[model samples]
Target: MIIASEKKRVFIYKDTQLSDPSINLSKEAVLNFYANTYPELNNATIDGPEIKDTELHYKFLSTLGTKG
Candidate 1:
């Protein structure tokens, strides 16, 4: 999974199981699973200083989660 903050980034990878509760329903789980499947997202360049803020970060991630 790719997890980033203003000062750091993280990458994780694993085989995802469709039966896993994390994969079965949660959008957060889906995003995390995709990130885990593709760790290169850890290298993505986030645009704007606003995106670097922790609150905005979660808000943006949550938007993706809720939207899909």
Candidate 2:
């Protein structure tokens, strides 16, 4: 998989302090995190910022030499 297009950011905020901290992190940063967390997934890209509760998730797919 590839990063087919530029990231589309969506600001998330929680009015109460109890909520998790929010920040607009780049896709590359997130991907790097996953890559570091799980060494086996060395060549991968992230897709989608699927928001659930107060968290953001992405679809981590391994790169198979495909162009975006």
Candidate 3:
């Protein structure tokens, strides 16, 4: 996999072959892997336009307690 740093215009190539199933990692180990890899993005913030429509998209399947 290839990862690019948009700000720095730097790129990195990852070797997928090295990630064999024989090598097992714990949850903490996996989290630490990502933490150490991208220290800059650890606590990044974002600001964007808020979502206007706060509605449920799907219809409710059951109304067991509803009264007419």
Candidate 4:
């Protein structure tokens, strides 16, 4: 008997789709990793892990707006 040991995780930031750099990193870690390139993510929130096909998808919801 054998078991599958791999699952793909994808993160969506605005108009960009980022691939997981490492399999061991947590979702939050992935977010922090990309924060260097996108500073706005520092205050951002995580959305879904919507499953599509065989991949896990996440969205970085930006919190960069003013209250009217």
Candidate whose TM-score is highest: 4
Candidate numbers sorted by lDDT from highest down: 4, 2, 1, 3
Worst 10 residues of 3 by lDDT: 8-17
Backbone clash pairs for candidate 3 read: none
Q: Which ten residues in a row have the lowest lDDT in candidate 1?
A: 56-65
Global local distance difference test of model 2: 0.49
Local error of candidate 2 at 67, Å?
19
Arrange candidates by TM-score, highest first: which order?
4, 2, 1, 3
Listed in order, each prediction's TM-score against the native is: 0.24, 0.41, 0.23, 0.84
Which candidate, 1 or 4, would have the higher TM-score against the true structure? Answer: 4
Candidate 2 versus the native: TM-score? 0.41
lDDT at residue 14 of model 4 (Cα atoms): 92
- Lowest lDDT sum, 10 consecutive residues, model 4, at 1-10
Q: Residue-wise lDDT of candidate 2 within 8-63, one digit each (tens)?
A: 44322122111122345466665565556555447866565786664555565665
Question: Model 1: per-residue lDDT, tens digit, 1-68?
Answer: 99864432221223322223232434344345555645553333322223342322221121222333
Residue-pair clashes per prediction, in order, are: 1, 0, 0, 0
Residues 5-45 of candidate 3: C-alpha lDDT, one tens digit per residue: 42211112122111211225532343334445545323332
* Alpha-carbon lDDT, every model: 0.33, 0.49, 0.29, 0.90
For lDDT, the strongest prediction is 4
* lDDT of model 3 at position 22: 20
